[model samples]
Target: MAEEGVMAHIPINHPARPVYRVLAGLIGLYIVVFGVFGLVETAGDDFFSRGSHWVLGLRTNMAFALVSVIFGLVVLFGAVHRGNLGHLMNLTAGVVFLVVGLAMLTVLQTEANILNFSVSTVIVSMLFGLVLLATGLYDKVGPPEHAETEREMRSSSSARPGR
Candidate 1:
Protein backbone atom coordinates (compact mmCIF):
# COMPACT_ATOMS: atom_id res chain seq x y z
CA MET A 1 0.00 0.00 0.00
CA ALA A 2 1.17 3.53 -0.74
CA GLU A 3 1.93 5.75 2.23
CA GLU A 4 -0.61 8.54 2.56
CA GLY A 5 0.94 11.96 2.08
CA VAL A 6 0.35 14.91 4.42
CA MET A 7 -1.48 16.82 1.70
CA ALA A 8 -3.78 13.86 1.22
CA HIS A 9 -5.29 14.37 4.65
CA ILE A 10 -5.28 18.18 4.77
CA PRO A 11 -8.57 19.52 3.40
CA ILE A 12 -8.03 22.43 1.02
CA ASN A 13 -11.55 22.79 -0.26
CA HIS A 14 -11.86 26.32 1.03
CA PRO A 15 -11.41 29.04 -1.59
CA ALA A 16 -10.21 31.54 0.97
CA ARG A 17 -7.28 29.70 2.44
CA PRO A 18 -4.74 31.66 0.41
CA VAL A 19 -6.41 34.97 1.22
CA TYR A 20 -6.40 34.21 4.93
CA ARG A 21 -2.72 33.35 4.94
CA VAL A 22 -1.73 36.52 3.13
CA LEU A 23 -3.90 38.81 5.23
CA ALA A 24 -2.75 37.27 8.49
CA GLY A 25 0.90 37.50 7.55
CA LEU A 26 0.67 41.14 6.41
CA ILE A 27 -1.42 42.33 9.33
CA GLY A 28 0.74 40.51 11.85
CA LEU A 29 3.95 41.85 10.38
CA TYR A 30 2.68 45.45 10.30
CA ILE A 31 1.52 45.36 13.91
CA VAL A 32 4.75 43.81 15.17
CA VAL A 33 6.80 46.38 13.32
CA PHE A 34 4.67 49.21 14.66
CA GLY A 35 5.09 47.91 18.21
CA VAL A 36 8.86 47.64 17.89
CA PHE A 37 9.10 51.18 16.54
CA GLY A 38 6.93 52.51 19.33
CA LEU A 39 9.01 50.85 22.02
CA VAL A 40 12.28 52.06 20.58
CA GLU A 41 11.17 55.69 20.15
CA THR A 42 10.00 55.98 23.76
CA ALA A 43 12.80 54.04 25.40
CA GLY A 44 13.85 56.86 27.70
CA ASP A 45 10.42 58.19 28.73
CA ASP A 46 7.93 56.91 31.26
CA PHE A 47 6.16 53.91 29.80
CA PHE A 48 2.70 55.23 30.59
CA SER A 49 3.22 58.85 29.52
CA ARG A 50 5.41 58.29 26.51
CA GLY A 51 3.22 59.14 23.54
CA SER A 52 5.79 60.22 21.03
CA HIS A 53 5.78 57.07 18.99
CA TRP A 54 4.42 57.20 15.45
CA VAL A 55 2.60 54.20 14.00
CA LEU A 56 1.54 54.38 10.38
CA GLY A 57 1.80 58.16 10.50
CA LEU A 58 -0.33 58.30 13.65
CA ARG A 59 0.76 58.93 17.21
CA THR A 60 0.64 56.10 19.75
CA ASN A 61 2.01 55.17 23.19
CA MET A 62 3.86 52.22 24.73
CA ALA A 63 0.77 50.47 26.02
CA PHE A 64 -0.83 50.54 22.61
CA ALA A 65 2.40 49.34 21.13
CA LEU A 66 2.42 46.34 23.44
CA VAL A 67 -1.14 45.47 22.53
CA SER A 68 -0.40 45.82 18.83
CA VAL A 69 2.62 43.56 19.09
CA ILE A 70 0.74 40.90 21.01
CA PHE A 71 -2.22 40.97 18.65
CA GLY A 72 0.07 40.87 15.66
CA LEU A 73 1.84 37.80 17.00
CA VAL A 74 -1.45 36.01 17.41
CA VAL A 75 -2.45 36.90 13.86
CA LEU A 76 0.90 35.71 12.55
CA PHE A 77 0.48 32.41 14.36
CA GLY A 78 -2.96 31.90 12.83
CA ALA A 79 -1.63 32.70 9.36
CA VAL A 80 1.13 30.15 9.66
CA HIS A 81 -1.39 27.47 10.63
CA ARG A 82 -4.20 27.35 8.11
CA GLY A 83 -7.37 25.33 8.87
CA ASN A 84 -10.62 25.61 10.79
CA LEU A 85 -8.89 26.96 13.88
CA GLY A 86 -7.02 29.58 11.88
CA HIS A 87 -10.22 30.73 10.20
CA LEU A 88 -11.88 31.12 13.56
CA MET A 89 -8.93 33.10 14.89
CA ASN A 90 -9.01 35.43 11.90
CA LEU A 91 -12.71 36.02 12.34
CA THR A 92 -12.35 36.73 16.04
CA ALA A 93 -9.46 39.09 15.51
CA GLY A 94 -11.31 40.96 12.79
CA VAL A 95 -14.30 41.56 15.00
CA VAL A 96 -12.18 42.75 17.87
CA PHE A 97 -10.26 45.15 15.69
CA LEU A 98 -13.43 46.57 14.19
CA VAL A 99 -15.00 47.10 17.60
CA VAL A 100 -11.92 48.70 19.04
CA GLY A 101 -11.49 51.04 16.11
CA LEU A 102 -15.09 52.14 16.18
CA ALA A 103 -14.96 52.67 19.90
CA MET A 104 -11.80 54.73 19.68
CA LEU A 105 -13.27 57.00 17.04
CA THR A 106 -15.61 58.41 19.65
CA VAL A 107 -12.82 59.57 21.96
CA LEU A 108 -10.04 60.63 19.65
CA GLN A 109 -8.50 63.42 21.71
CA THR A 110 -10.11 62.84 25.08
CA GLU A 111 -8.32 61.66 28.20
CA ALA A 112 -9.96 58.32 27.54
CA ASN A 113 -7.33 57.82 24.88
CA ILE A 114 -4.28 57.39 27.06
CA LEU A 115 -2.54 55.71 24.15
CA ASN A 116 -2.87 58.49 21.58
CA PHE A 117 -5.81 57.69 19.32
CA SER A 118 -6.33 59.17 15.85
CA VAL A 119 -8.57 58.94 12.82
CA SER A 120 -5.87 57.24 10.82
CA THR A 121 -5.53 54.51 13.41
CA VAL A 122 -9.24 53.90 13.40
CA ILE A 123 -9.41 53.73 9.61
CA VAL A 124 -6.45 51.39 9.34
CA SER A 125 -7.81 49.11 12.04
CA MET A 126 -11.21 48.94 10.40
CA LEU A 127 -9.69 48.18 7.01
CA PHE A 128 -7.59 45.38 8.41
CA GLY A 129 -10.63 44.05 10.22
CA LEU A 130 -12.63 44.02 7.01
CA VAL A 131 -9.92 42.13 5.18
CA LEU A 132 -9.71 39.54 7.91
CA LEU A 133 -13.46 39.18 8.14
CA ALA A 134 -13.83 38.66 4.39
CA THR A 135 -11.05 36.09 4.26
CA GLY A 136 -12.49 34.19 7.21
CA LEU A 137 -15.90 33.97 5.59
CA TYR A 138 -14.54 32.77 2.27
CA ASP A 139 -15.25 29.13 2.99
CA LYS A 140 -18.87 29.91 3.83
CA VAL A 141 -19.58 31.60 0.52
CA GLY A 142 -20.55 28.27 -1.15
CA PRO A 143 -20.00 24.56 -1.19
CA PRO A 144 -16.92 23.41 -3.05
CA GLU A 145 -17.60 21.38 -6.20
CA HIS A 146 -14.29 19.52 -5.87
CA ALA A 147 -15.40 17.88 -2.64
CA GLU A 148 -18.41 16.33 -4.37
CA THR A 149 -16.26 15.01 -7.19
CA GLU A 150 -13.86 13.55 -4.70
CA ARG A 151 -16.65 11.78 -2.88
CA GLU A 152 -18.04 10.34 -6.10
CA MET A 153 -14.60 9.05 -7.07
CA ARG A 154 -14.17 7.36 -3.72
CA SER A 155 -17.62 5.74 -3.86
CA SER A 156 -17.12 4.50 -7.40
CA SER A 157 -13.70 3.00 -6.63
CA SER A 158 -15.01 1.28 -3.50
CA ALA A 159 -17.88 -0.26 -5.46
CA ARG A 160 -15.60 -1.91 -8.08
CA PRO A 161 -15.22 -5.69 -7.65
CA GLY A 162 -11.81 -7.17 -8.42
CA ARG A 163 -9.89 -9.65 -6.32
Candidate 2:
Protein backbone atom coordinates (compact mmCIF):
# COMPACT_ATOMS: atom_id res chain seq x y z
CA MET A 1 0.00 0.00 0.00
CA ALA A 2 1.24 3.53 -0.80
CA GLU A 3 -0.20 4.53 2.61
CA GLU A 4 -3.45 6.31 3.29
CA GLY A 5 -2.05 9.25 5.19
CA VAL A 6 0.40 11.95 4.14
CA MET A 7 2.13 10.66 1.04
CA ALA A 8 5.82 11.18 0.49
CA HIS A 9 6.94 13.72 -2.06
CA ILE A 10 9.32 11.85 -4.32
CA PRO A 11 12.53 13.28 -5.75
CA ILE A 12 11.08 14.16 -9.15
CA ASN A 13 10.00 17.66 -8.29
CA HIS A 14 11.85 20.95 -8.43
CA PRO A 15 14.59 20.90 -5.78
CA ALA A 16 14.65 24.60 -5.20
CA ARG A 17 10.90 24.63 -5.26
CA PRO A 18 10.50 25.91 -1.74
CA VAL A 19 12.98 28.69 -2.32
CA TYR A 20 11.18 29.95 -5.39
CA ARG A 21 7.82 29.43 -3.82
CA VAL A 22 8.63 31.40 -0.70
CA LEU A 23 10.32 34.12 -2.67
CA ALA A 24 7.45 34.31 -5.06
CA GLY A 25 4.95 34.46 -2.25
CA LEU A 26 6.85 37.21 -0.53
CA ILE A 27 7.24 39.11 -3.74
CA GLY A 28 3.60 38.70 -4.61
CA LEU A 29 2.41 39.79 -1.20
CA TYR A 30 4.70 42.76 -1.29
CA ILE A 31 3.44 43.75 -4.71
CA VAL A 32 -0.15 43.47 -3.63
CA VAL A 33 0.49 45.57 -0.57
CA PHE A 34 2.55 47.99 -2.60
CA GLY A 35 -0.19 48.37 -5.17
CA VAL A 36 -2.82 48.88 -2.53
CA PHE A 37 -0.68 51.44 -0.83
CA GLY A 38 -0.15 53.24 -4.10
CA LEU A 39 -3.83 53.27 -4.82
CA VAL A 40 -4.58 54.62 -1.40
CA GLU A 41 -1.91 57.25 -1.71
CA THR A 42 -3.02 58.20 -5.16
CA ALA A 43 -6.49 58.71 -3.87
CA GLY A 44 -5.28 60.92 -1.05
CA ASP A 45 -4.64 64.62 -1.18
CA ASP A 46 -0.89 64.61 -0.41
CA PHE A 47 0.25 61.48 -2.28
CA PHE A 48 1.87 63.37 -5.10
CA SER A 49 3.91 65.55 -2.80
CA ARG A 50 5.58 62.79 -0.76
CA GLY A 51 7.76 59.74 -1.41
CA SER A 52 9.59 59.08 -4.67
CA HIS A 53 7.51 60.94 -7.18
CA TRP A 54 8.55 58.66 -10.01
CA VAL A 55 7.33 55.52 -8.29
CA LEU A 56 4.18 57.29 -7.33
CA GLY A 57 3.30 58.29 -10.89
CA LEU A 58 4.93 55.82 -13.27
CA ARG A 59 2.87 53.28 -15.23
CA THR A 60 5.69 50.77 -14.89
CA ASN A 61 5.37 50.78 -11.11
CA MET A 62 1.68 50.10 -11.39
CA ALA A 63 2.36 47.18 -13.68
CA PHE A 64 5.10 45.84 -11.41
CA ALA A 65 2.90 45.92 -8.33
CA LEU A 66 0.10 44.08 -10.12
CA VAL A 67 2.42 41.46 -11.57
CA SER A 68 4.25 41.00 -8.29
CA VAL A 69 1.07 40.22 -6.40
CA ILE A 70 0.00 37.88 -9.18
CA PHE A 71 3.32 36.06 -9.32
CA GLY A 72 3.35 35.56 -5.58
CA LEU A 73 -0.09 34.03 -5.67
CA VAL A 74 0.86 31.79 -8.59
CA VAL A 75 4.04 30.63 -6.89
CA LEU A 76 2.13 29.89 -3.73
CA PHE A 77 -0.29 27.75 -5.69
CA GLY A 78 2.58 26.09 -7.55
CA ALA A 79 4.23 25.22 -4.27
CA VAL A 80 1.10 23.38 -3.32
CA HIS A 81 0.43 21.83 -6.76
CA ARG A 82 4.08 21.09 -7.65
CA GLY A 83 3.90 21.60 -11.40
CA ASN A 84 5.68 23.25 -14.33
CA LEU A 85 3.24 26.09 -14.81
CA GLY A 86 3.86 27.30 -11.28
CA HIS A 87 7.62 27.37 -11.66
CA LEU A 88 7.34 29.09 -15.01
CA MET A 89 5.05 31.68 -13.50
CA ASN A 90 7.49 32.22 -10.67
CA LEU A 91 10.38 32.57 -13.12
CA THR A 92 8.45 35.18 -15.02
CA ALA A 93 7.59 36.99 -11.81
CA GLY A 94 11.19 36.96 -10.60
CA VAL A 95 12.39 38.29 -13.92
CA VAL A 96 9.86 41.06 -13.76
CA PHE A 97 10.83 41.96 -10.20
CA LEU A 98 14.53 41.93 -11.04
CA VAL A 99 14.17 44.02 -14.16
CA VAL A 100 11.84 46.49 -12.54
CA GLY A 101 13.92 46.75 -9.40
CA LEU A 102 17.12 47.46 -11.27
CA ALA A 103 15.43 49.96 -13.51
CA MET A 104 13.57 51.67 -10.73
CA LEU A 105 16.40 51.79 -8.23
CA THR A 106 18.03 54.59 -10.13
CA VAL A 107 14.78 56.38 -10.60
CA LEU A 108 13.99 56.05 -6.92
CA GLN A 109 17.41 57.31 -5.96
CA THR A 110 17.11 60.27 -8.27
CA GLU A 111 13.91 61.34 -6.66
CA ALA A 112 14.08 64.18 -4.14
CA ASN A 113 12.51 62.13 -1.36
CA ILE A 114 14.67 59.01 -1.72
CA LEU A 115 16.86 60.05 1.18
CA ASN A 116 13.88 60.79 3.34
CA PHE A 117 12.35 57.32 3.33
CA SER A 118 12.42 55.33 6.52
CA VAL A 119 15.68 53.35 6.48
CA SER A 120 13.93 50.00 6.74
CA THR A 121 11.72 50.49 3.71
CA VAL A 122 14.72 51.22 1.51
CA ILE A 123 16.61 48.21 2.79
CA VAL A 124 13.69 45.88 2.50
CA SER A 125 12.91 46.96 -1.04
CA MET A 126 16.53 46.42 -2.08
CA LEU A 127 16.54 42.96 -0.55
CA PHE A 128 13.29 42.17 -2.28
CA GLY A 129 14.89 43.01 -5.63
CA LEU A 130 17.89 40.76 -4.99
CA VAL A 131 15.72 37.86 -3.92
CA LEU A 132 13.66 38.08 -7.09
CA LEU A 133 16.76 38.13 -9.27
CA ALA A 134 18.11 35.07 -7.52
CA THR A 135 14.81 33.28 -7.81
CA GLY A 136 14.86 33.74 -11.59
CA LEU A 137 18.08 31.70 -11.91
CA TYR A 138 16.19 28.59 -10.97
CA ASP A 139 17.60 25.08 -10.58
CA LYS A 140 16.15 21.84 -11.88
CA VAL A 141 15.38 19.31 -9.20
CA GLY A 142 14.79 15.55 -9.36
CA PRO A 143 13.57 13.67 -12.43
CA PRO A 144 12.97 15.77 -15.51
CA GLU A 145 9.62 14.13 -15.89
CA HIS A 146 6.75 16.31 -14.81
CA ALA A 147 3.13 17.07 -15.48
CA GLU A 148 2.71 16.21 -19.15
CA THR A 149 -0.21 16.25 -21.51
CA GLU A 150 -2.54 13.25 -21.42
CA ARG A 151 -1.35 12.10 -24.85
CA GLU A 152 2.31 12.55 -23.92
CA MET A 153 2.05 10.65 -20.68
CA ARG A 154 -0.04 7.90 -22.23
CA SER A 155 2.59 6.97 -24.80
CA SER A 156 5.30 7.34 -22.17
CA SER A 157 3.59 5.42 -19.36
CA SER A 158 1.65 2.83 -21.32
CA ALA A 159 4.62 0.53 -21.77
CA ARG A 160 3.58 -1.25 -18.57
CA PRO A 161 -0.17 -0.98 -18.45
CA GLY A 162 -0.50 -3.51 -15.63
CA ARG A 163 2.31 -2.24 -13.47
Candidate 3:
Protein backbone atom coordinates (compact mmCIF):
# COMPACT_ATOMS: atom_id res chain seq x y z
CA MET A 1 0.00 0.00 0.00
CA ALA A 2 1.35 3.23 1.20
CA GLU A 3 4.91 2.15 0.50
CA GLU A 4 3.98 0.80 -2.90
CA GLY A 5 2.16 3.97 -3.80
CA VAL A 6 5.13 6.08 -2.76
CA MET A 7 7.51 3.98 -4.85
CA ALA A 8 5.18 4.20 -7.86
CA HIS A 9 5.10 7.96 -7.60
CA ILE A 10 8.86 8.29 -8.01
CA PRO A 11 9.40 9.80 -11.41
CA ILE A 12 11.82 8.12 -13.78
CA ASN A 13 13.22 11.44 -14.90
CA HIS A 14 13.91 14.86 -13.47
CA PRO A 15 11.05 16.93 -12.12
CA ALA A 16 12.18 20.06 -13.94
CA ARG A 17 11.86 18.42 -17.34
CA PRO A 18 8.81 20.39 -18.35
CA VAL A 19 10.17 23.80 -17.41
CA TYR A 20 12.26 24.32 -20.53
CA ARG A 21 9.58 23.03 -22.88
CA VAL A 22 6.92 25.24 -21.36
CA LEU A 23 9.20 28.26 -21.46
CA ALA A 24 10.07 27.62 -25.08
CA GLY A 25 6.43 27.20 -25.98
CA LEU A 26 5.56 30.48 -24.32
CA ILE A 27 8.36 32.33 -26.05
CA GLY A 28 7.35 30.85 -29.39
CA LEU A 29 3.74 31.84 -28.93
CA TYR A 30 4.69 35.41 -28.14
CA ILE A 31 6.93 35.66 -31.19
CA VAL A 32 4.28 34.19 -33.47
CA VAL A 33 1.60 36.52 -32.22
CA PHE A 34 3.76 39.63 -32.52
CA GLY A 35 4.99 38.56 -35.95
CA VAL A 36 1.49 38.01 -37.23
CA PHE A 37 0.46 41.37 -35.88
CA GLY A 38 3.38 43.03 -37.62
CA LEU A 39 2.48 41.38 -40.89
CA VAL A 40 -1.12 42.48 -40.67
CA GLU A 41 -0.22 46.04 -39.80
CA THR A 42 2.18 46.36 -42.72
CA ALA A 43 0.03 44.57 -45.24
CA GLY A 44 -0.41 46.05 -48.77
CA ASP A 45 2.99 47.68 -48.66
CA ASP A 46 5.91 46.77 -50.86
CA PHE A 47 7.57 43.93 -49.02
CA PHE A 48 11.09 45.18 -49.73
CA SER A 49 10.51 48.87 -49.22
CA ARG A 50 7.99 48.63 -46.44
CA GLY A 51 8.62 51.42 -43.97
CA SER A 52 9.11 50.68 -40.30
CA HIS A 53 5.97 50.36 -38.22
CA TRP A 54 5.25 49.49 -34.63
CA VAL A 55 3.27 46.35 -33.98
CA LEU A 56 2.42 45.24 -30.49
CA GLY A 57 4.39 48.36 -29.51
CA LEU A 58 7.54 46.91 -31.06
CA ARG A 59 9.05 48.40 -34.21
CA THR A 60 9.68 45.92 -37.01
CA ASN A 61 9.55 45.28 -40.74
CA MET A 62 8.08 42.59 -43.00
CA ALA A 63 11.28 40.58 -43.20
CA PHE A 64 11.65 40.53 -39.45
CA ALA A 65 8.06 39.44 -39.09
CA LEU A 66 8.64 36.54 -41.46
CA VAL A 67 11.77 35.56 -39.64
CA SER A 68 9.92 35.73 -36.34
CA VAL A 69 7.27 33.38 -37.72
CA ILE A 70 9.90 30.90 -38.84
CA PHE A 71 11.71 31.12 -35.54
CA GLY A 72 8.46 30.64 -33.67
CA LEU A 73 7.63 27.50 -35.62
CA VAL A 74 10.96 25.88 -34.85
CA VAL A 75 10.84 26.85 -31.19
CA LEU A 76 7.24 25.73 -30.87
CA PHE A 77 8.06 22.37 -32.42
CA GLY A 78 10.91 21.89 -30.00
CA ALA A 79 8.66 22.82 -27.08
CA VAL A 80 6.01 20.31 -28.17
CA HIS A 81 8.56 17.49 -28.10
CA ARG A 82 10.90 16.26 -25.39
CA GLY A 83 14.60 15.65 -25.96
CA ASN A 84 17.92 17.33 -26.69
CA LEU A 85 16.58 18.61 -29.98
CA GLY A 86 14.31 21.11 -28.33
CA HIS A 87 17.07 22.44 -26.15
CA LEU A 88 19.35 22.80 -29.12
CA MET A 89 16.71 24.66 -31.06
CA ASN A 90 16.05 27.04 -28.22
CA LEU A 91 19.77 27.57 -27.65
CA THR A 92 20.39 28.35 -31.28
CA ALA A 93 17.48 30.72 -31.53
CA GLY A 94 18.60 32.51 -28.41
CA VAL A 95 22.08 32.98 -29.71
CA VAL A 96 20.78 34.30 -33.00
CA PHE A 97 18.50 36.74 -31.24
CA LEU A 98 21.33 37.92 -29.03
CA VAL A 99 23.58 38.50 -32.00
CA VAL A 100 20.88 40.32 -33.91
CA GLY A 101 20.14 42.54 -30.95
CA LEU A 102 23.76 43.44 -30.41
CA ALA A 103 24.26 44.11 -34.08
CA MET A 104 21.28 46.43 -34.11
CA LEU A 105 23.02 48.59 -31.56
CA THR A 106 25.67 49.48 -34.10
CA VAL A 107 23.07 50.67 -36.59
CA LEU A 108 20.74 52.44 -34.23
CA GLN A 109 21.07 55.68 -36.11
CA THR A 110 21.29 54.17 -39.59
CA GLU A 111 18.53 52.66 -41.72
CA ALA A 112 20.41 49.70 -43.14
CA ASN A 113 18.65 47.15 -40.96
CA ILE A 114 15.73 45.33 -42.48
CA LEU A 115 14.26 44.66 -39.09
CA ASN A 116 14.20 48.34 -38.19
CA PHE A 117 14.82 47.40 -34.59
CA SER A 118 14.46 50.12 -31.97
CA VAL A 119 15.94 50.55 -28.50
CA SER A 120 13.03 48.78 -26.87
CA THR A 121 13.07 46.05 -29.48
CA VAL A 122 16.77 45.45 -28.99
CA ILE A 123 16.47 45.38 -25.22
CA VAL A 124 13.53 42.99 -25.30
CA SER A 125 15.19 40.72 -27.83
CA MET A 126 18.40 40.50 -25.86
CA LEU A 127 16.57 39.81 -22.60
CA PHE A 128 14.40 37.16 -24.17
CA GLY A 129 17.41 35.58 -25.82
CA LEU A 130 19.30 35.44 -22.55
CA VAL A 131 16.38 33.77 -20.80
CA LEU A 132 15.98 31.13 -23.51
CA LEU A 133 19.68 30.49 -23.64
CA ALA A 134 20.02 30.09 -19.90
CA THR A 135 16.94 27.88 -19.64
CA GLY A 136 18.13 25.64 -22.46
CA LEU A 137 21.52 25.25 -20.87
CA TYR A 138 20.18 24.43 -17.43
CA ASP A 139 20.77 20.82 -16.42
CA LYS A 140 17.71 18.71 -15.82
CA VAL A 141 17.08 17.54 -12.28
CA GLY A 142 18.11 13.90 -12.00
CA PRO A 143 15.79 11.13 -10.91
CA PRO A 144 14.98 11.18 -7.19
CA GLU A 145 16.79 8.33 -5.45
CA HIS A 146 16.00 9.28 -1.85
CA ALA A 147 12.38 8.34 -2.43
CA GLU A 148 13.38 4.73 -2.88
CA THR A 149 15.13 4.65 0.48
CA GLU A 150 12.12 6.27 2.11
CA ARG A 151 9.84 3.70 0.53
CA GLU A 152 11.95 0.83 1.82
CA MET A 153 11.99 2.28 5.32
CA ARG A 154 8.25 2.78 5.25
CA SER A 155 7.73 -0.79 4.10
CA SER A 156 9.79 -2.20 6.99
CA SER A 157 7.88 -0.10 9.51
CA SER A 158 4.49 -1.09 8.09
CA ALA A 159 5.37 -4.78 8.21
CA ARG A 160 5.70 -4.72 12.05
CA PRO A 161 2.90 -2.81 13.69
CA GLY A 162 3.33 -3.96 17.27
CA ARG A 163 4.14 -0.48 18.64
> Against the true structure, what is each candidate's TM-score?
0.74, 0.46, 0.72
The reply for model 1, stretches above 4 Å from the true place, is 1-12, 139-163
Best by lDDT: 1
Q: Using TM-score as the measure, what is the rank order of every candidate, best first?
A: 1, 3, 2
Each model's lDDT comes to 0.73, 0.48, 0.72
- Mark the regions of model 2 whose C-alpha exceeds 4 Å error after superposition: 1-12, 44-81, 106-126, 136-163
Clashing pairs in 2: none
lDDT of 3 by residue, 1-163 (tens): 3437533443333446577668878988988998898888777766644376888778877887888888878778867766656656766878987998899888877867657778988898898788777656642223356545655666798899794
Q: Is candidate 1 or candidate 2 better by lDDT?
A: 1
List, residue by residue over 18-46, the lDDT tens digit for candidate 1: 86678778988998998888777766666
The C-alpha local distance difference test score for the whole of candidate 2 amounts to 0.48
> In model 1, which range of ten residues has the least summed lDDT?
1-10
Model 3 TM-score, 2 decimals? 0.72
